[model samples]
Target chain A: MGIQNKYYGWRWGEEDPIFKNLGYIQNVLGYIDPADKSFTSNNFKELFYPGDFDLLQKSWKKYKKGTDHAFEMSYRFKHKDGSWRWIKESGLANVFNTSNNPIGGIGTIQEVTDKKKKYTQLKSILKNVSIIILRLRQDSNNQITVDHISKEALKYWNIPCETLLKDEGYLRNLAHKDDLVGIRSALSNSFAKMEFFECRWRVVSKEGNINWCQGVGTPLKDKDGTCFLDIVITDITKEKLYTEQLKVSEEKYHSLFQHSPQPSWVYDLETLAFLNVNSAAISKYGYSKDEFMGMTLADIRPECELENLEIQVQKTRENYLNFFDGYFKHINKQGEILTVHLYSSPITYNGQKCRQIIAIDISEKMKYLKFIENQNKSLKRIGWMQSHELRAPLVRLMGLINLLTDQDSIGKEERHYINTEIINSANEMDIMTKNIAQIINDAQLKEKMNDVQIIAG
Target chain B: MTYRLLQVDDDPVILFLHNKLFSKYTNSKIEQFKNGRLALDYILIDNGPDISYLLLLDINMPVMNGWEFMDEICNHGLENSTSVIILTSSADCTDLDKSKSFANIVHFIQKPLTKEKIEKLPLLMEYLALQD
Candidate 1:
């Protein structure tokens, strides 16, 4: 898309909704009066910062000469509300379309106040930038001698500017001993290679504080054919400290992602492409890193589980706080299906909207639950045998005992037969009791197997 | 177009079976190799771009296995013109899924091919008709 099409997609008029609400107006450049229809550079200057206006003039000249395609600059501008607003202004000179002569320039102005606010806060630190500019001369012995120092050196090092003017070795002595070798080698290499030199080193101040400093230098020769280095030194202690802290925090975050017990990954919200995956995720899903990159989240899902995934994705988009924890079937590279429960959270990964998920494989848990259900059925069967089987045998023994009599009038043969039957009934009862006891013992052994404890390190 | 059948397998039995079976079809030449490296050299460099051959690839070999050979042929821009049908004993579904990534792979089949199984392949039938 061309720049003009992007910026001018909406025709500027009072009828346009955005322009009507924001009270946007456009004018031609170099016109004398604000009320005139023709644009004026003077009025444009009123809406821009001095640095931005200078950039516009330079870029505009280059565009007119066909050396540059477009001119773009962003800076603080006075808004309709009488407040300073940061805005970007872009221009393209001579937009050719069947024209013999050069056409007038076209441009766009947009409000970037929100993004500029962050830069403004940081800009406060640079209000009085104490950059110490210096010039150095190199002798034939490959020795560097400081020739001049800017007046700002006094404010930073607390030594008079003339002290550097008199003593050439004063600057080298101020640098920390540990940082000297690296800094000197970098400077010499840049000189020999005819490349720009930049390095950071620590400098010991007069107040006994060590400050991080950066030097950016360029090598040049004067009219007398003598080599010199023009360099800029800046105190960057706060920036260095902030960078170190940020690196440590990022390292801790990455380690946790890698060492977590569950398989985890981060995927783009729109495309569902995996942006990052942990080692556990790679091994569990049975895919190499390259294969994962080429696949979407849908590829791992079983066909039956895709509907639920679609619904969950919609709910997440509606509100990232609307979390989901549900079991879904996933297919591995080998076509073996696994059940997993995902704990997902919306995250911004590398500035793109994405989701981070910790997937817990629940296949083994499902198997364990099924095993317990089967065990319950066996226990019910054992209970039935203990209650019904013992009851029937006891009733038969009672009936047989009732038929025998204690009176002396009974026949001797009848009494002998009754005694024989009583012995037989007693033996049958003994066998049934032993069988019930054996069943109970077997049940106890099965229960003991469940006592095995699992420990994870 | 006349077709050439190139079989790469470490097992001597399978290689002999592939050569004996494929050579039965008229107007087609069958070449067998014990490993992927020799087949790759024949296809890409030895014959260059002038001659195109159908491949019977095996997953495991002594050197430069089938996967590495597939990667090489694709990188050399010979994948589109060449036809590959993996004939291996492995029934791994992972290999079937991975074959979709290559441009030339037409079929993934189990090994110990019989006369009936060979006739069932549509690509093989088309090539058989186009022989000479």
Candidate 2:
């Protein structure tokens, strides 16, 4: 075993009695040589040992001359139990005397097994915490750095934590190009105000896919007012897309409502007033928006038609039917009576009874019916003339020709002349009948032609 | 003795042809009235021969048409006892339908009276005889 001597408050010879009383030191197997008076009794034996004696001597000689030379060494020592025990030996060299420069040193040796065990336990705890804790640091130049990050962060980024921490530009490069400027500005503003900021932006992951991230950041400012941002990011792409889709759907419904060609209206069932009316309904009914809003079905229809309209409303309320069509007299803004064909259906508006109606005018159809009646009257007159007056004259002409041809018992020359006269009169009667027939035919043809034109028109 | 037959029509040619044809064909005196009003007056006043005389009626005549004259005679109940036939060149269904409304309308014949159609006139005589 090695021993170290340390000097205390007394001179070296004055401590000789104390050293002599220590039998463990006097019975030592090793002795010091006087030729090298620089050597100490404790260090001499350690230096003469075979393994590290030269190194120890060289170190002692090199440091012995310093005004303050205190040294400590730990090594294995042989114990009485025939086993090696770890020990620490410490000594302070005496450098108080100027003339008698070489004195003894005093030291103590102790075992440290319990302290080593505690230190190992503390080191294990530190390693565990290092794997879970994350710390970020930034310089005064706004260069961000990550000190310690959990392994989970490395897996999530699909890159080594060291790579990400070493280069601040690597994290900036992940930000979407379009959002980089705004994100940087927001971060700067947040730090300047020493406030928290939250924003959503696109980022490129290590896998090269664009991801939407909602980042909430707080400024960590130092006493000098310099700040760094610590941000937490969460994925919110699906929710953002759903919100955009909802907006598009609302716009589509609005377009359909505004631009549909059919005249459509929603009416309040209780008040019988129009709740909503499209442009087509306004133009068709010749009513302003205010006028239509104030009027009810009974006000628009004739008094006699109100009962039928009420029945339709009752049926709609009962849910007996969804659609119906009927004819009603409509008065325009000018008070002109119009025959209108109406189609109505039940609908719900804001959880209230409502109906939609479409109307068409049919006044021209009634006019055509009256015109047809007149045409029938004229045709009857023509038929009466053909059957009665024209037949009478033709009947007489046929009788006359029959009589003239039936004549007998007359002189040949006189018969010839009379027969010639009779034949001439008969031919003239035939020509007259033919002209009358032609006139009737022409009148009938004209009537038919007029009828065709009316139908085509 | 010949029975006098009065023919009324607005057309002059139709009137002349009627006078000549009836005079040569039948042993009856035929008189021509150009308008329905004149014919109605003559038939009302004359009532000639005390043997019913046939009144050939033309529907489209000036002053008084056939329908008006017939209506007048009917209102007076004169058409019920007189022998009358509606002679016209119209083949309209409306005129035919109107003929049914008048009891005095004995027969309806078309215009341009041919010999074959005239030969069938004995059917009118047969109807008159049946009435007698």
Candidate 3:
């Protein structure tokens, strides 16, 4: 046995003091005796786990071929406590007969059950996480390479993990042209400061699809003194799209509000303070935007309408979600009373409950209505005068002429009286007609003046 | 019983025409006044329980118009004995409508007291028959 052991170059015997003292080596030392052809003795079959039998058989077949090389394999082994453990076995077949047939083999076994379990857990974590994790290493020569990449990187970027590890430029080249300088600067800064690194950039995948990505990394150092960066890249395409669309919509509405022809304003509901006023409001109210900002809704109301304004404000506060429309009297900077038609609606403005109001100046329209009313009154008076005052003399004239023509039994004196009466009635009708015509002419001139005023206005 | 015909107007020509028209239509003597006030005063002083009056009243007159005269007549309890026929040159529908509100106003005639219009007054025809 000693000569066979010496031939295998394993001089340590079962009772050797040095080997016995090395309890760690003693527990992992395993042997295969060529003399025991099937090698089933010494509890070999009992300690070998059934699941790893094929691995053991394959290793033994190489040894039986008389190949003089060291081989290593990982398999499950039964411990003394009846628990299965992952074991890494490394062995060399050195003992051979004169005929060159191997007689025995020696190997060392290492218990790696904890390391295997941790590796499986890490792999499972990497597989379940949606974000791509990349481990980048920088050597002493300042060369950087992708040391490890998660399975998600392969799925996300549509690039093979081996390809990324082999060609370090593959991932870097995927960065958008516009963001290349930013990526370089951020990386250099992180490396120089040994600080947390963060960058937002776009990446074009192998499928030619663009993706918005955010990369966050922590600079670290491995046991070997090599610098490393563990980075997590998250897909932010949806969020970026949402923010961009929101920006565009806000700009659109802002322009609409600013350029509207009617006077419009936004006021806080709780404070009744002006939050925003449009250009039209600025010009129409004769108040600058800064001045309006410092004033409340009551500032534009006449003294008599203040109480009504208070009541309306209270009602609006209670029904903040409702739309309101009304005609109100307002006073401007010039102290001219104006009739304004107001349209208001509730909205969330600058994160506050507020109402936006549009005011249409209708003072001129009211004036026009009043003018129409006065004209109608004048027309009615003229109708009464035409029916009664003007017709009275004309009827008298007709009657006198009838008397002259139809009455034949009258005397000369009566005929002379009737002739003078006819002339008097005719002269009366002529003056009255002239008076009515003058009155009508004055009314027409007034109407024409009003029409010109309206057109000019 | 006595029956009298009265003509009231602010216009002298209208009063003259009334006299001529009534003279041609009936033999009953007709009295004329320049305005409702004169005619109302005449009625106040001369009207008797046994006397009946038919007034030809003009609406647009100075001092106590036809409407005021009718109101005074009503206030004096003379509406039953005094019948009024509105005589004016007014073609106003509102005046016709206003005449309906006075119970004593029996006829609305647009004027110069034409023969046909006078002939159309049933109250005048009845008064003339009463005179006979």
Question: Best-fitting candidate, measured by TM-score?
Answer: 3
Worst 10 residues of 3 chain A by lDDT: A1-10
lDDT of 3 by residue, A1-457 (tens): 1111111224222321112212332254332333523223344445667857666667656545646656677777665556666656566656767876555456665667777899888877766665788787878986668877676545656543556678867456447778988987887788778889999998877677888989899889889998899888888888899989999998998999999999999998888899999999888889999999999988999999999988988899999998989999988888878899999899899899999999999988887787777778777877887898788888888777767776664678878887787888788778877877776787778778888987885
- Name model 3 segments beyond 4 Å from true: A1-162, A170-174, A194-198, A205-207, A216-234, A298-305, A331-337, A409-457, B1-132
Docking class of 2: incorrect
Task: Give the range where candidate 1 chain A is weakest over 10 consecutive residues by summed lDDT.
Answer: A12-21
**What's the i-RMS for candidate 1 in angstroms?**
34.1
Question: Interface RMSD, all models, one decimal each?
Answer: 34.1, 6.6, 1.4
In candidate 2, stretches whose alpha carbon ends up further than 4 angstroms from where it belongs are A1-263, A346-353, A368-457, B1-132
Q: Over the full model, what C-alpha lDDT does candidate 3 score relative to the true structure?
A: 0.76
**C-alpha root-mean-square deviation, each candidate:** 36.5, 21.4, 10.2
Q: In candidate 3, which residue pairs clash?
A: none
Candidate achieving the largest lDDT: 3
Candidate ranking under TM-score, highest first, comes to: 3, 1, 2
CA displacement after TM-score superposition, residue A338 of candidate 2 (Å): 2.4
lDDT of 1 at A167: 74
